[model samples]
Structures are given as C-alpha cells and as structure tokens.
Target chain A: MQENILTLRDIVVEFDGERILDKINLSIRDNEFVTLLGPSGCGKTTTLRIIAGFVEPNAGEVLFEGQKINGVPPHMRQVNTVFQRYALFPHLDVFENVAFGLRIKKTPKDELNRRVMEMLELVDLKGFEKRSVQSLSGGQQQRVAIARAVVGKPRMLLLDEPLAALDLKLRKEMQLELKNIQQSLGITFVFVTHDQEEALSMSDTVVVMQDGVIQQIGTPEDIYNEPANAFVADFIGDSNILDGIMKRDFLVSFEGQECACLDRDFAPNERVDVVIRPEDVDIVPTQLGIFTGTVESSLFKGVHYEIVVDVSGYKWYIHTTDNVEIGAQVGLKFGPEDLHIMHKMFDGTTNVLQGEVVGEDEIEFLGVRFTRENLGLPVGAPVRLTFSPYDIIVAPEEDRDATVYVESVIYKGRFSELIVWKDETQLILRTQRDEQVATDIGVDFNFDHIKIEPLGEKADA
Target chain B: MKSKVPAYPYFGWMAVFTIIPMLFVLYFAFIGDDGQFTLDGFRRLADPYMIAIFLKSLWLALLTTIICLLIAYPMAYILSRMKLNTQRTMMLLVMLPMWMNFLLRIYAWMMLLENNGLINKLLGFIGLGPFQLIGTTGAILAGMAYNFLPFMVLPIYSVMTKIDGSLIEASQDLGCNFFGVLRRILLPLSFPGVITGITMVFVPAASTFVISQRLGGGELMIGDVIEMYFVGAEPNFNTGASISLVLMLVILIGMGIMNLFDKDEMEGMLI
Candidate 1:
C-alpha cells in the first residue's frame, strides 16, 4: 500500500457561527485520486479550501507529508488549485498565465519557455499560447487553468469543480482528460464535486459528506456495494429503504413476508434499516414470489424501465429491462445477497405518524384515541402526530388504549430499549425493566407530549 | 427610428446650450473687435505674460492630479474590500461634501489656510512658527486636490468592486505574494478607472479660476486671464475666445495621449 501524503485531523471550520466542517478526518495516499462528494452546502468546497490553505480551520491541524501546516500561506504551500470558474488572469495571454509561477520563481528564460510549451502541449493547446485568455472558449480556458496550476509541479492538485461551467459533452470529455492527466503526472489529486457520477467515475476513494459530517469513506466499489448507512445508500444510487425486524441470524421480516439476508451480530428481533438496489429486484409472477404489490408507475428510462411498485403503503423502486404496465399486480423477488441491513441512524426517539381528527379535541392513530385542547381541526381532517419515545408508557395490564406485542428489548446504557408492534405500526420506547420478547403488553401515549400538525392544502387557509 | 426619438430633445438642448456657444467662441476667436476677420486675437496669445499664466495653470493642474491619484487609488482599493454596508456608508461620506455650495466650501478652506487660521493656530500651539500659507501656490493646489478627490475615488472604487475575488486567490495559488498580486492583477485591471479619474480631475483643475483667486491672493492663472479678457474690469471677448480655444486644444492633445493606453476602454467611457 502507498503511504499517506496528506492527512486532516479533526478539522473544524465555522463561518458566521455556523459549523461548515465538523471534526472531519481524512487521509490521502500518494498518487491517489480522492473526491469529496456531496450536495451544495455540504462543505465539500470548504474542505478543498482547507487543504489548499485558502481557508484556515477554526480548530484541528492539516498535515502535509507529516508536517503540521496550520498557518502556512497558500503561496508557500506545495499545493496548487484550479478554481471553480477557471480564474484565468484576464489581462495575461495563455503563455504568460502559465508562466506566472515560473517567472515568480525566476526561472531562466530558456527553461521557462521549454516548460511552458510542454505544459501547453500536455493540455493540447500547442499553438494557442499567444491568444489572450478572454478570447478563448470555456474549455480552452479550463485547459489553461489546468496547465498553469500543474506547471508549478506542486505535490498535489486541487480541482474545485473545474468542469462545472462546460456543456454536457465538453464536461464528459474533460472528465476523462483530467483522469488521464492525473495518472500520467503521478500527482495526488483532491477533487471536490456535487455530481455523484463524476465522483464515482474519477476517484480512487470517495468520501461522502453531509451537513458538515463525513458520512463514509471507502473505494468507489466499497462505497457503492456496502454503504455505511441509509444516507450513503440513498445518495450513491437509487435504493429502496424500508424498516425491517431482524428475526435472527440470516433472517429478516418486512412487508408481511420473511426473507433471508447476509447481516448478523444483531440482538434477536432487532429493528434494522434494509436497503435494496433497484437493479437487484426481479419481477415475478404474483403467486411465486415473497410478496406482491400493485404497480404504481413505470417510466422507460433509457437502458431500463424504472418501475415503482406499491407494496402496502411503501413505494419500492425496481429497475429491470422488462417493462411492466402501471396499475398491474406484480410480485418482486430478490436473493438474500441483495439485501443490505444497517443499524438505524436515529435512536428511535421520535415517531412521526399520520392520523385523522375525529373531533375538535380528539385524534385517531393506530386505532387509538388521544385528546387535546384547541385542536381547531374539523372532523375527518388529515393530520400528522409526532411524539418522543419517553411519551410511551408500557404496562403489563391489558386495559390500556392499545395492545402491543413486545418484539425486542436491548440493553441501553441508561435503560432498556423496547420495540413493540401494535397491528402494523411499530413503536420504540425506553423502559426501566426488561421486557420478554413475544409477550403481550399494553401501551398508552402522554397526550401533552404529542404535537399535531395539519396535513395537505386543506389547512392552508 | 423609434429608438432615436428620445435623443432628439438632447440634441436640441446641445445646440442651444453647447454648440451655439462654441460657435460664438470660434467666431470671436478669429475676428477683431471692429467685427472684421483678422488674426489679432490669436497674435496676442503669444505674449510672454499670457504664456507664463498658461504654463503655471498646466503645472498646478498636473500636480493636483498626481496628488489626487496617489491618495485615491489606495482609498478606493480599501473601500472596495470593505463590507457592503460599510462601503455604502463610506461612499456616502465621500459624496457628502459635494452637496454644499462650491463657493462656500472654498471659503471654508480659505479660513483654515489663512495666516492666523485654525491650522496655523495648531502649529503655534505645537511650538512651530505661523508660516505663510494662504496666498501661495500650495494653497491653490490644496484646494483643487481637495475638491476633486472624490471624482478620482468613485470611478476606481466602482471598477475595483466588480473584479472577481477568485482572480486574487488564483494569483496566490500560483505563488504570488501580496505586492505581486497588486502589481500583476489589481493594477492592470483597474487601469480604465485610473484613466477616467485622471481625466475627471485634471480637466476641472486646469480651468478653475475661483480657487487661485481666493487662495492665491493675486497669483494669476490662465483661467483668471481668460476671465479678465471676457468679463473682468477690462473685457475683451476676442482675446478670451482665442485663449479658450488654445486651452481646449492642449487638453484634447493630453487626453488623446492618454487614450492611447487603452483605446477600447476609452471608447466605452466616451459613449
């Protein structure tokens, strides 16, 4: 394995009291292409700036070749950046722009000319050196910016969405060209982009970030095949995420059917988030599959048909070359290897459920009634109820508002966490005493803890 | 045809206010006082006294323009980098003096520059002599620079603010220090604004008679000579028109030289 050329330790950056990077730690290997991938406002650009020394993190240290360079200026750092807009000097010609760094270093005339001409040829701009930057096309300017940054022969190159301003065909062409250049030069390239396909195609390692936190880091194949969490699974590609109960080793149950999986090391009957790629599912006859559902919509998306099936109330996206008609009954089938189970991100504290107002002060959900003051909602109006786990009271008696079956009880540091089911709805709560799995229990809600919000356009007035 | 309609009123106003007056100047420049066409007025401009006055006006204007440029470029660069709200507030302060009457502002400067004025009083308190200040060439130059400083600053600030900030970062990324960035990027990019500022300040400073009269205490300039010939105690419209024609030619020649630096930008400014 190659050695790590750059490392970021607990890097934190804040702007106007808003944390843009939260304790981000990463390592880039020598001659590696690492991509920071996320949507806009996800701090990918800020992370690039931190490495380039254009932005100083509020805390933590940036290590380059085992040296701490916290306050080193950008000019002194052995790293160069190609800005987002290809910020070529408007007043300088292409040759002069590429020669700027060399001229600053006071290189001899013959050597400077030879090196500049070589760089221009590398970017395929052989005879265009004398043209002013303002007169060049966007892709040509992008080439000039690349040539200029790399002409200095820095240890690493940082590209901030260098192809973002080009057209689709041009961007595709540049993406391949950039990858080729990085390989030929043998320089570490740290790229930042919001385009998932671009990141997946160009990088040796993909670091997925969201909301100032690094979600996962692995090779492109590892990140795509074995995502760390639900966010990573959903962000990397089209996926169907569903709530499931891990019955035991190699067995899970969801959508009223039991299926085998490859995940283990969970408490028996534990709640887990199940991810299935759209391309992994195969449509089968209704009576010969694990589950059946009505097709909600089918879109012919180029290479495959994107079919959305309504399994109970949840929509499962399936990509298959076989075309399925909308509103037709269909059965989905997938092997055990296709199922990826992950620990749920939340601690199951907050429960969001859809309900209807039965009266001015009464709401109905999971066949249970709750009363409040000043609901102001008319009868039969749709609403949503959100309550915390602490609001649920589990008791041994069967006289409560709803009867539930205790599915699991796992030991938490402060208390035991319980997952109970009332009909088709799952409720998670904390209890002081251990509860036996598969035992009958009664549950009630604390009316004061539930927050009600009206649903749909009917409440707009 | 429709777009040209709005310009007709402006053309009519120019004919009445500008073109006709210039035609009168041209007519009187070549004609004698007896209304016969002659070169007597042009011949009088060769007098050594009038030539000296012209030279003095040119020298004072050049000095004032140089001083204004030196002070305004840095001020404009700093102001452009300030926060948007602070930039607005600072620009308002820079423009505030123009709101008061021009003559009133010059008189205020006179009171501060006189022998026993506020400035000399402070110098006296600091154990310095009350030197001669008000009736010297320095006073006239000071007044001209003070009045035209905002003109120099406004254009440069407007230009500098439009510069993309990433260009500066790119320079640094390519190993440019602070002074290197300023010299290679900021200076070249702000050239159009500097040219505009020079033209604005120099043209007005070269033609003003009031500052020399109030502050120079009898130091005569070309403007004062033109005034004496046209509207002063001894009025001679012919001689005044010829001097005005000559001054206009000199200023045009200077601007033509300046325009050679950046022709495209100059054309943009002209239209």
Candidate 2:
C-alpha cells in the first residue's frame, strides 16, 4: 500500500452555517501529483486551504505523515501554499523573499545563503537577488512566489490555481514548468484548477467535484472514457444522445430507423437513449450508403466537412469527407456497433410531435413550441428527422408541465451547436450543418430514450 | 533623476518674497539707536537673559517633540490599523474640543487645575492625593504634549496607513519577529512622516502662548520672555524683534536637518 503523505478524512467545513464542503474525503500518496478539478464554489479551493492549514475544518481529521494535524496554524504546518494572487512580500528583494522561510526556521546563515541561491537558480531567476519585487513582471513575480514557498522544502505543496492569473499561453507554459518542477523534486503536490485541460494534462489523478461533493475520482483517461453518470460524460466531452425504444437484445429503433450499440444490458422493449459521438457517425459515398438523404447544408471544417442531410422527413448531421452541395441528394450510412445505449433519464409525454413544415423559423402544430433559430428549413421542404437514439432528450419528469422551444444555432466550421429552451432552461446541442429543422416542420420525438435536466429540476440525465 | 538646481533657479521668486523681507530685517538688525548702520539689534541678542531664553526655547521645543512622539507612536499605529469609520470618529472626537479655541482649552484646564477646582473636588472626594496638575515644568510639558500630540500622530498615521502592510508580513516571513519587524520595516518605511510630525509638533510647542501662561503659572519659558520683551517694565522692540528673528533662524536650521533625513523616504513614496 502506498503511504499517504497528506490525508483528509470526511472533512466537513461550514461557513455562516452553510456547508461549503460536506464530508470531503481525500488522500495523497507520497510524492504524487494530485489535482482537484471543479467549477467555482465546488469546495476544491476550500479543500486545498484546509490541507495547507489556512482554514480549519469544522469537523473530521486532516493527517500529515500519520499525525492528525487539525488546528495547526499555517506557518507551523509542514506545508507551503502558493496563493492564487502570488502573495509575495512587497518590501523584500528576491534574495530576502526566498530566505524568509529559512530565516524563520533559523537555518544557519551560510546554509541559508546557499539554499536561497540554489532555489533562485532553479526557478531561473538567479540574478534578481537585489532587484525590488515591484520591478518584476507577472511571470517573474509568480516564479518568486514559487521560490518563496519551496525554499522552505516543506513536506507538501498546496497550489490554489497558481496560474489562474496568467494569460492562456503563459498558463500553458507555467503548467508544464510546474509539473516538471514537481516531478524533479519528488514532492507531493495538491493542485486546484477549474480548467479541464489543465487537470487532464498535469495530474496523476484527477478528482472532480460539484456542489461540495465528490463527483468522480480516477486516472484522467478512466474518468474521461468511463463517466460515472451522464453529467460526468457530458461535462468531460461533447456527446450526442439519440432517443429510441429497445427492440431486441442489443438493438434500438429511432423513428423507425433501427440501430445497435454495445452498452449495459437492458430490458427488452425498455425505453432508452443511445449515445454516439459525431466522429462515430461515418459517411460513405452515395452508391454505397446505408440510408439515403438529400444534402441540406455542407460546411467545410478544415479537416472534415460537416454535412446535414434531409433523410426521409428527418434532418441528420453527418461528418463526412465528401462536400455535398446544398440541394444535392446523398445517401447516409451508419452501423450497429457505433451506438452507446444508456437508460432513459425522464418520461416525456407532452412534446412528441409529428408534423409538416409551416414557416421558415416558426412552426405551427397546435400549442406545441418551435424556434425561429437553427430552423433554416424551407416552408414546403419535407424532412424525416432521425436522431441517434442518443440525442433525443426528455425533459426531467418534474418539469413535465414545462416545454422546450428552439432559441438559436451557432456554426462551428464542421457543425453548429443549437441553443434550445425548455420553459426557462437552456441547452446547447452541437448539431451539424442542416437545412434548419424548419421551426415549421415542428419538433416531435418518436422515441424517448434520451433524457435531460429541465426547468426547476434536480439530478443529472 | 535629480534636476540640477542651477544654484537657486527660484532665486528671483525667493528674492521677491523672502529676500525682500530678510533685507528689511537685516537693515533693522544693523541700525543702532544713533540712526546709523550698526550691530545694536544683533548685539541685543547677546544679552545673558536673551541667551537664557534662546536655550530655554531650544530645550522646550526638543522636550515637546520627544513628549509628542512618546504619546503618538502607539496611537498612530493603532489608528492606522483601525477601520476607516472608527478612525474618523475618534479623530473628530479628539479634534472637536480643539476647535473651540486653544486659549479656551487652557482656561478650562486652569479651571480644573486650580487649588479648589473640579480636579481637587474629585481628588478630595477620593481622599487619596492632592496632586499639583499645574504651575511647574511638568505642567508646561503636559500642556505642550497634549496640544501637539495630534499633529504628531496624524502625519505618522497617514504614512503608516500608506506603508504596505505586506512589507511587515514579509519581514516576519524573513524571520524577524514582531519588534524587529517594526524597527526594520515599519519604522524606516514611515520615517518621513515621523520627521514631519516631529517638525510640526516642535515648531508650535516652541512658540505657543496661553498654555504656558495658564498652566506654567509663572514659568520662565521663551514664550514668556518674548511676551515680556513686548509688554514688560522695559519694553525693548528692537531686542524683541531680534529675538523673534533668531527664533526663525533656529527653526530654519532644524528644518534643514529634517529634509536631509526625509529625502529617501520621499523618493520611495513617489516610486
């Protein structure tokens, strides 16, 4: 078993009687790189501060080297923190700043001078000993902050979004440099960041949190490839959900279009959603295609063309190499192995509409809703809409009374993300170039496999 | 960065206001009773009593500066750390009574310090001690310290508030404990304010009236001597004016040393 360098057990912190961290449990192995990733107010920063002894948890234990270290003041803890603001001393020069921790510990003068110089050189700021702190740039000031903390050679380092203030390019460079520095020193690091890419790139283990609770903890690839829930899956990457009703052992049908997926076993005839990625939907030539459609829109996406084809009466976004012009007819093809089926997250009975085109951006089908956005469909064009059993979203059961309407569409070179509204809830779906789903064709769901969070609803779909 | 002064670039401006006045004083300083150019006015300052008053004035100013500092250092530190609202309220409270009039404050003190006054009434009721709150060098010192303490404290507090608090933390992180941090970081960083406060305190303490007259009773202070020369048994206008001129010269010399100490602090603040 790996020895835990700094261990936190069921740490609960409450400020003003409101829980910020509700029973958080985390452990760091010796010399390991650990990152806490989450949105703002997710307790990641609070946890880092707890370990650094900057904040005292209301309950539970924090152990350093097997000793319960609760209530130890920040200065006395065998830990150093690099605050988000780079809390460097303004009055002191670089030499004095780095030597600060050493001097506090009363390390001998010769030893102090030697260690300070070595550390400054390590941060590549060797000749800045006599320069005033205010004279340095942001990046250099950040280095000085790092040197100030590490010069003490603490057992663990707590970084609270240290590169958060730097620009994107600087942030990336500093991220690599910080990671390399951690590797060379072989010291335990507990880093906090909201940037998903930063966490994935630098951490040995990634801990994702939300609402002060741990969402998932695993290696980066594991967390990315196998999400614990739909939220984790969607949050980590772009996902397309197609709603369908299960028909066979591993098959599902979406608006009469049959598809197959490899996923958890489900009840035969059970309602479910099939999750598929855009890259998974392969496009072939018209003569060899599985399904047929006419090109509604084709967008060049540098490496690939995002094509929207009108299949039957439905619009399907397809990633293809061939650039089919608008109004040109083409064939669509997909296989059974490309779908990832998951259980339906809601019961949608109000918004299943089957209709004909009425107007450009506005559709008319009784009181059922439509959007003037993303709907570029001509007034008379017929479209047989086909959603991968994955992308059809059912409003959460609690918002049964609420309804979704189309709001807007954003065009990314290869595909466009549709902004849809359900009552007051908003969702952005990265769909492909299409002859808009004429707000007139009127949106209707034949299958109810996919589900989503709606207005005034709780829990992930 | 120092601009060349070009041997008094503002000499013409000074000549218009300062040198013209100095020329008049100089002319008066040299004219004797015989109505001829002589050193009679300057010679009057050489008298033994005049010399005593000069020494007394210097010592009194020095004493007031020291006393103001002793009372102000902690007050300034505490005030700087206080919340803005609290500091402002306390300042108003301290200065409200002051706006009434310096002479009024002194007379009120006289009322309290008299043999049968409010202080004695309180002391007699306590039945413990009959302390003489007035009519001595101690009383004069107390009066000067009380009246001048705010001037000393305000400048220091303003400077203290401006000095970055992180610098002290930096010092502590560098291993200097509380006392050493204050001495090395806070004091030096705020030295200019301290110099200004000291100058402000000493200047008025050396020349203020009423406080000495009422509190010191009959003390032989320089202020008292100046008043005597102006309105005494043998009123000597020439000697009195000469004495005032000498006091002004002494103040100038004191200010020169003060500016020398403050140059670096002034530069630091500018940066």
Per-prediction DockQ = 0.39, 0.15
- Please list the residue runs of candidate 2 whose C-alpha ends up more than 4 Å from where it truly belongs after superposition: A9-22, A40-47, A58-60, A209-214, A226-461, B1-100, B107-127, B136-142, B162-177, B180-185, B218-241, B244-271
**Candidate 2 residue lDDT tens string, B1-271:** 7765875758878988998978765555565556687656568778898788678767877998998897788788888888899999977876777677877777777887777778888999989457777797777877778788889988998888876654554444334556766766778777878998998998877777667777887666666766776789987656666667788788889888889867855553443
Sort candidate 1 into its docking category.
acceptable
lDDT of 2 at B10: 82
Q: What is the TM-score of chain B in candidate 2?
A: 0.83
Candidate 1 collision pairs: B229-B236
Tell me what TM-score chain B of candidate 1 gets against the true chain B.
0.94
- After superposition, the stretches of candidate 1 with alpha carbons farther than 4 Å from their true spots are A247-249, A267-270, A349-461, B1-5, B38-44, B121-132, B264-271
lDDT of 1 by residue, A98-206 (tens): 9999998999999999999999999999999878887889999999999999998999999999988899999999999999999999999999988888999999999
Model 2 misses residue A348 by how many Å? 13
What TM-score number comes out for model 2? 0.66
Worst 10 residues of 1 chain B by lDDT: B262-271
Q: Candidate 2 - CAPRI tier? A: incorrect
